[model samples]
Structures are given as C-alpha cells and as structure tokens.
Target: MAYKFALCLTLPHNTTKMKKKTIILLILAAIVGLAQFIRPDNIKKYENGVKTEDLAGVPKEVNEILRNSCFNCHSSSSELAWYDKITPVSFLVASHIQEGTEVLNFKDWMSMSIAKQKAVLYYSINKIRSGEMPLSSYILAHPAAKINKNQMQVLEAYLLSISARGKTDSVKLKALERDHKWVKPALNGIAYMPDYRNWKAISTTDRFDNGTMRIIFANEVAVAAIKAKNINPWPDGSVLAKAAWTQEIALDGSVSTGQFVQVEYMIKDSKKYAKTEGWGWARWKGDDLRPYGKTINFTTECISCHRPVRENDNVFTIPLNLK
Candidate 1:
C-alpha cells in the first residue's frame, strides 16, 4: 500500500515537470515566431545623395562584370534575393548592404576628384588581382560573379592608365613617412575628423611592425572606386582629411618602451559638425594598444568607425604602386 501511494505522489510531480517544460518550449517557439515577423527581410539603399555620370572610356567587358557581380553590394541597386527577406538572414543582408554602401556606392560616383577617380580604378584592379574582392562569401552564393585568371588580367590591363596615375601618389606617401615627425600627444584632447564617411581607427599591423610599434595606417577609405566608363562622382567622403601617423618603439628583452607620434587633428569646419566631430589619437604600448593619453574634448562619432579599404589600415586611398 505504501509503494502504491508513493507511486501516485511521484506521478504528479513528473506530470508537473513535463507540463512546465511544454510551456517553456511553447514560449520559446512563440518568441522565435515573433522575431521573424518583427525583423522581416527589408533592405533599403542609403545613398550619399550624389549623382553618377555616364560610363565613358571604360571597357564594356569590365563594366558588365561590375554591374552583374559587384553592383548588388557595391552599388545603389542591390539585387535582393528571396532569401534576403527571411529572418536572421535578412539582418545579415541588410548589414552587408549598409556596410558595402558605406564603403563604395556605384550610384554616387561623380563627386570625387580626378585623382581619386583614377585611384578607384586601380584599387578595383588590385582587389581583383589579389582576389580580395567580390568577397569569398559573396562568390559562394553567386558563382557566376567569379572570374578566371584571364578575366582578372584583362581587367587589370584595362586599368593600366588609371594605375599609372595612382603611381604619382607614392611620392607623397614616401615623403610623409620620412618628413613626418614623431610626436607623442596625450589622448584626452579634442579630435577632429573632416568627414564621417572616410574615417577609421589606427590599426596595429603585425606584418609591418615586426611585432613592435605595430604598423598603423589611418585616414583610409573603405572601398575601391569604380573605373568603369560613365561612372563618375565616385563619392567625395571616400577621401579622408585628418592627421594620420605611425608610432615607433624601443624595447628590452621582456618589455617594450618608447613612444611615437599617435595622431592629432583640429576640426576644420566647426559649424558643419558637432563637438563629437573633433580630433582624437591612439597610443600603442606593447599589447595594450588603445586610445590613450591626452585627447581633445570631442566625440569620435565621425571618423573612428569609417570602414577600411585595407585590412585595418583606414586609409585605402594610398595605392600600392607596383607599376
């Protein structure tokens, strides 16, 4: 009799436990369903509000490749797939579009300077040659966008003129490196960034720094400009206007020491931007590389987050002149 009574009591407890689990599962299901409804696939293009000119003096083959393969993300007109409308995936697609548009927008290609126009073409050719563009993830989805070695070479050859012009900037880069003095400024002062669209943080490149000061490139653009014919305006904010420099270090066996000039800039246009749009710098000491020292009392909304064209070196305008 005692055993049967114990069984009855235990049965109710098990029943209650199962009921709670069912309720929890149902709630989770409902939450997921609601999330799908809330964040449906809705992608939109955000233009820098500039216009583009006609394709002039560009190879027809190169133009077709860009429009069919790259334009979806790199241009204003994104070819949204049906999968883009699904949950979770929708957010991913939207983010890609946002980031891609932020870096390079084909819709607004005419606003850039002639020097920049040439730079864009060369950058694209390099990106293709290095196989760093059309992103592997993108190519996985769209196999047709993939190019052969011959196609890549063809595009590169077609861009030889633009690349030739980009070579002129190498002198400036070399001059800046040699002439620029190393000034270690405190990181708590005002920082200035000219345009929000063309800014990024100082990155620590292990490849360039020999594991020391960590080579940093700043004031970089995010994407290569188009060189296709009739593609003008090329975007203005793609060019960064601010102070950019690298740091040097002295080291011991176990510890690293010394300081190099970080970065400093004053707001050139105070009326157009807010105090948040000020000057800032970063210091790299050993492994603890963060924005430190004296800084101007300004916010870092505009420049600190601009997408980089290179790995992390914000300044992508500087073409690697192999020509």
Candidate 2:
C-alpha cells in the first residue's frame, strides 16, 4: 500500500513537468509562425528593369559574367531565392541590395561617360580580384554568383585592351616647365598648392582604366588627425592632395611613372564649405596645370562620386598608421 501510494504521487509530478514543457514548445512555435507575417517591403517593385540596350557596347561574354556575378545585387534585376524571402533573411537581402546599388548602379551605366564607364570597370575588377565582392554571405546562398578565374582573366584582358597609352608632347612639356610657378586657382577659388609635393604620402592607388598611378599626400593637420584616430571629420584646415601620372610599361612587363596626369585637392573647413559637404574640392589637369572646371558646379561630380563614403566624411583613402 505504501509503495502504491508513493508511485501514484510521483506520476502526477511527472505529468505536470511534461505539461509545462509542452506549453513552452507551443508558445515558441506560435512566435515563429507569427513572425512569418512580418515581411519587409519588396525592393524589386521600385526598381527599373535592366535592358540589353543599356549595356550596348559591352562584349557579350563580359556582359554574361557581370550579369551572372554582379547584377543580382548591383542591378535592378535581383533574383531572390525561395529561402531569401523569409522574414529576417529578406530584410538582410534587401539591405545588401540597397547598399550595393548605392555604391554602383548598373542602371546608370549608359548615362555615364565612356571614361567613367572604364573607371567603373577597373574599380570592379579590383574588387573582384580582392574577393571583396559578391559578398561571402551572399555567395554562401548563391554559389553561381562567385566569379571564376577564367572570367577574371577575360575581364582583365578587356580592360587592358581599352586602356590608351600616354603619348609624349615635347612642346607641351617644355611649356609646363616654363609655367611651373604660375598655376591658376580652381573655378571654386581653391588655389593650387605646389608644395603638396613635399607633403608625406599617405596612400597609393593605380587607375588601370586610364593607365595611371596616383599618390595621396596629407598635410600636417590631416596627418595629426590620422595619428590621433580623429579623422572622421578630418579637422578644419586639413588638406589632402592626390597626384596622378601615366604609367609606362616596358617590354619586360615592368611599369614606371610616365607623364603627369592631374592633381586633386580636398581642403576641410566645415563652416566655410557647408554648401560643398565641408570640403573645398579642386582639380588641375595635365603638366601645364590647367584648372579642371568651367564653373563652380564641377564640384557636384566630386560630391556625387564620394557620396557612398559619406560616413567617412566623403573621404576615400584610409591613411597608413604612423610609427
């Protein structure tokens, strides 16, 4: 009788524990089911269709590779997988597509100048070679988007074939030497600072599209801000200079600087430059140092190109850390 009583009491306690577990599982299931109804706004509805005519000059093979690897996020014709439509995952997918298009939109391809198109291709090639594109998270779900080595070689060859080599102009060179001391100010009133050549080089870049190499130099104010890790706004009076030169390729495949191309400057003064994103933008092209714009509105192009990096104060170069 005593053993029977103890057994009966334990059965009720075990039943209560099982009932609590069942209730907890049902609540979790309900939460997951309800979450499925909370979907993000479809980003595709607002996008324009990408037509073949928009990519008129692109070779078919190159276009195929770009469409397969890049268009899903960079263009309007994004192909979302079934799993990508899930609530949380769909939100992430939409965010990625939005950011990608903001950085480089294929829909704007035909609208860009031929020179700008080439520059975009060069920049894209660099990102692909570095494996910084197609995003690892994205590639995980869509393996077909990963660019293969053969595709990479094809893109590289096309870029090289289109790049024009710099030609020598002795008369122009002589004139440039003679007029070295009389460079003019930009249309927006930013003066040419020839002494930027003496500033410390903070970074270097190559423009394969134009067959040019560039060196970025920072003024003392910029350098100090960089060292102090306070360069987001780049303190007032900070100046940066980017000088470019044509690249001369030797028979042995060696490359060296050839002719001067242009030099651009960015001077930070938040209050003074409030209308131009807190920086005075200027560019002087060629060895003769001719100002690059007919009107002050030319700064509009610079502002647009740097808009994607607004979080970084519209600055692109990340300065090297000082020892």
Question: In candidate 2, which residue pairs clash?
Answer: none
Clashes of 2: 0
Q: Each candidate's TM vs. the true structure?
A: 0.38, 0.45
Whole-structure CA lDDT of model 2: 0.83
lDDT of 2 at 271: 97
Off by over 4 Å in 2: 1-181
Q: In order, what lDDT does every prediction score?
A: 0.50, 0.83
Overall local distance difference test of candidate 1:
0.50
lDDT of 1 by residue, 1-323 (tens): 99999999999999999999999999988886687776633364322322333344467887776766677677666666666655667777677777777787766555433444456777776787688887898788678778777777767776664445565655654343332122223354323232332444333332244433432223333223322211122233233323323433435544332343333332223234333332222332321123443344323432555334324233323323211
Residues forming the 10-long window of minimal summed lDDT in candidate 1: 225-234
Candidate 1 segments whose C-alpha is farther than 4 A from its true place: 1-36, 40-42, 46-56, 161-323
Which number leads on TM-score?
2
Measured with C-alpha atoms, the lDDT of residue 28 in candidate 1 is 87
